[model samples]
Target: MLRRTFSLLAAASVLALTACGSGSPSSTGGTAQGGAAGGGDLTKVSVGVIPIVDCAPVYLGNKLGFFKDEGLQLDIQTATGGAAIVPGVVSGSFDFAFSNLISVMVARDKGLDLKFVANGASTTGEKGKDVGGVVVPAGSPIKSAKDLAGKTVSVNNLSNIGDTSIKSAIEKDGGDPSSVKFVEVAFPDAPAAIANKQVDAAWILEPFMSKALADGGTVVSWNFVDVSPKLDIAGYFTKADTIMNKPELTQKFTRAMNKSLEYAQAHPQEVRDIVGTYTKIDEAARSKMTLTHWTVTFDKDAFKTLGDAAAKYGTLSKAPNAGDLLP
Candidate 1:
């Protein structure tokens, strides 16, 4: 959510470097030829990811050898938020990355060539029981989304999906969406921010959302569900040229990623188990956290609705072209 000016400069510089250095294979070591399950030379891929419940499938997929089955050796990198991940992908630091749909759209809006290759995570679409929601301190007067007007709300990102969907929910509840102020507070820190009265409400995700509730925080809105019931929240994405020049690589990644999604969905306990390996989330929080819906397909209609809301809320200059962005 914190997009520094230098990140854009770094992106441009790295793009040029990647173009010049691409002819030679990267020095990063991978499984030897015929070492993979599919018996071919393994492509060493670097992936940027955020350490959160939404990204559990990718970690699970790697653990289950799905990537190896596709002849890939993944070198997964963790960033704090999409702010770094988006720029990393654009600059070619990552062969692929996981990010929310709105961040991808914002990158595209900025003339960065990025595309969603596979589904990452979606909302369960069940109010008060979804993976994430807006929470206020217990006994706070802000009892509903409408009451959020003129209050300071904390989101991980200011203009990305969090605030965009929240604004939609506020307007739907007859609140003046523009009247609310949004601040950037990372999910890990948001619970404390709310507790200390630093913000009127914080839109948080698991396992922090579950922790906030356990600590007596109150849920006010399931923002994603309020925006659209079938919303696809995030996905695996890569540079446009990666799709064009290395079609086979992208195809293989998509297949492996899809497999991971399906496996995670089928094995919810495994998803919780895998989450602990990458993130600092403890076992108890992992078990109690709400799991996001995982799938191989994108809900284009839901995405369009989210995009339109983003545009209306000034997150984007205009809604992104789904045909161009979606795989």
Candidate 2:
């Protein structure tokens, strides 16, 4: 299966502008613990999310009335990258946000008080499955990871899983990892770029991964599995203050989200049915895409392995303790 933690490296630069923006929850003032099955004053919250297949649970929860069942109204905000979303969450415009562990750790390393509320996505650990892949034009001379040397690869972001995973895959195959060049292209735009030979290979995720393959993009490697066998890639997170000031709201939200996650894992077709509603991928494409492993708990050891890899690749200055990072 494919595992991805790609980045739009420039997002870090946009954090300043995002931090200054403020937004309030849509509805307020019921009780300290309001009418939700749990007890919380706040029943409305805005969530920051990217339009990707990984966000199935959030969309599923909203559409199936899971959030409403728990007495919460979810206001969904779509953004291109986490850089824009993270600041919104930090500034209170978003009560919670979906983000990759790398971006969250980068923010935490810079002193953002964040906590994982639920696990959003993980890899299937099936080596050649539909998780993530580095694809080239059909019948290209590039046959293995070693052939990637001195070639340009397209990733959704820089200094992220796209680059790190690709590099690891290349090195494992005896290629000069440092010789590879990486460029940033949005996931939707990557297939066209690769087909046109703009980049030698494109780091692609599901739904799109299936589309790229249909478009004659040849799979060169699965970058993520080579990085680690089982990985917890991304999750939903909120500020510590949200947890402290609105304990019941947080609990209710978590419960609803956990229920949605369980539903997503158990019902892939149902999850795929709603992916297009929240994202650009259509029903046809959604039917072809591979779903991610969903969970509510962030496994401590899995995160540490990812963190250590990030530090080794210079994504982080030092490896962070998983316990200190999680709530």
Best by TM-score: 1
Kindly report which residue stretches of model 1 are placed more than 4 angstroms away from their true locations once superposed: 1-7, 11-40
The whole-model C-alpha lDDT of candidate 2 against the native structure comes to 0.77
- lDDT string for model 2 (194-267, tens) is 88899898999987788789998888888777667677788888888778888888888889989989999999
TM-score of each: 0.91, 0.85
Per-candidate RMSD, Å: 3.6, 4.6
TM-score: model 1 vs. ground truth: 0.91
lDDT of 1 at 163: 91
Clashing pairs in 1: none
lDDT tens digits, residue span 1-327, model 1: 434233665754654364322332233233445545556678788777888888889899888899988878777877766777787777676788898898888888888888999999999989978999999998899999999999999998678889999999999999999999999898989999999999999999988998889889999999999999899999999888889988888898899999999999999999988888887889988888899999899999999999999899888899888998999
Report the poorest 10 consecutive residues by lDDT, candidate 2: 1-10
TM-score for model 2?
0.85
**Model 1, residue 114: displacement in angstroms?**
1.0
lDDT assessment of candidate 1: 0.85
The prediction achieving the highest lDDT against the true structure is 1
